[model samples]
Target: MTNADKKILKRLKKEDKKALTELYDSYWEILFLSSYNILKEREVCEEIIQDVFIDLWHNRAKLQIKISLKAYLYACTRYKVFAQIRKQKAIKVELFDDLKKRFQYTNPETKMMDKELVYQIEKTISTLPKKCRIVYKLSRNRQMSHKEIAEKLSISTKTVENHIGNALRVLKKSLGYTFSILFL
Candidate 1:
């Protein structure tokens, strides 16, 4: 770790909120730029930075610093951005498979199964509040980041994030049982 990072770590270890704020201020732009480059969305970049800070603060006591804070934060942001991309790719693949199955079979039994899956997806989505649904759709379908969605929808980035969290929670609850059957 750099001397500056060591100093910040020392202060942070003592539970200094000001040090945490300073750390954030010091690295936010660098982390944002790194995330923006990978995700190509400003809103997502901001959200990634926010999450990094939250994680850092919440897990401060448990964190062991072996690298410069800047390097560590950049690494964290890169991983999160890549993880989000992977999730989007997986969702797209699942949707594509569903579409393929829908087209390949004319048997009534298979058709009914396909219809049920579609209905489940639609039903889970329909349970979301209007804004959450729109946010989820834009993020998943349009591949827009939270920053882009917030800007387009005229809402705060935090609000965009909350909507996404709510949507995911609802989807997870709705699909939790199905996931085990489908995967196993």
Candidate 2:
């Protein structure tokens, strides 16, 4: 945060309403757009951002931020968006029986297709350079965050991101038709 942001934060800690409004006015739109990119639902994204601001107000005095307010806000919004996705996935799983009745498909075919894709994906991964393969496996198999992979590999976060990006590009090229389906 800049000195001006620090001043606003200090005022917010003192429970100043103007500071709260200032923070909200400055951040709301960017935060809303970030959430919308993930959730793709305007109303839900709006509510999530509003909830974040309200939570900020409620815990203003106790807010401990190691990064800038922008980083903090973005991280919070991302987490909430991912949480919402998890909830939606759970609900979808619960509704699977109803959904299955509405569609006609054989599970064995789906399972076979999945297994074939997995085998092809593994083959593609095995062809990557050693560092890229390691980073990709740590990210996809272990479910580690980029920062965690950086820390584990004793590399910078940007390096980790680049490796992951390069790995994805290679996989997309190698898999061709299969790549788009994996992402979807």
Candidate 3:
């Protein structure tokens, strides 16, 4: 850690509210930008930054300081972004299911076909190797870039790309006929 970081940590450890406020003032913009880049939502990014400081305040005693404070704060923001994305994805899935049910009431035949398509997709996903499944889900479902997936999974970016490629190949092969109808 840098000398400035050491001083900030020392002051924070002593429960100096002015030190904490100064730290936030100094780093808030950078942290906000980082969170906004990852989350792409203004309000959510603001909330994540707020949560990061809250977490730092709550867990200051347990925090270790082997790395630069900026790096630590960036990591915390990244994790919060991922958590927010996951929550949003879960909500989207629920909303999609609800829409499907509503659509079913209007068109039984279309609903049946939609159900079959979802089943086929699920079966194809189930056939993927474990790591491929995870990489594919993170890329497609969570809308994460290869670098983000790599960081989250603690794998190399190249490895994340390769897994995503393999998963896509398998999916294309399994669903080629159906995909042709949809695309072509």
- Sorting all predicted structures by TM-score, with the top scorer first, yields 2, 3, 1
Give the total clashing residue pairs for model 3: 0
Cα displacement (angstroms), candidate 2, residue 66, comes to 1.5
- For each candidate, what is the lDDT? 0.68, 0.68, 0.67
Mind giving the per-residue lDDT tens digits that candidate 3 earns over 1-184? 7899889888887888887798789777777765565446798888888987887776666555444566556556655765676687645544344433443332443344345555656688789899989998898777799999999999999999899878767655664422322211
True-structure lDDT of candidate 1:
0.68
Candidate 1 per-residue lDDT, tens place, 1-184, comes to 6788788878887899999999899878766765565456788778888988887787677566554465456556555765666666745544344433432243443344335544665688898999999999999778799999999999999999999888877765664422312211
Kindly list the per-residue Cα lDDT of model 2 for residues 29-141, writing each as its tens digit. 77776666555689998998898788778777766553356555654555576567767774554433432222112234333433445565688889989999999999988
Q: lDDT (0-100) at residue 6 of candidate 2?
A: 85
Model 2 shows how many backbone clashes?
0
Q: Model 3: how large is the Cα RMSD against the reference?
A: 18.4
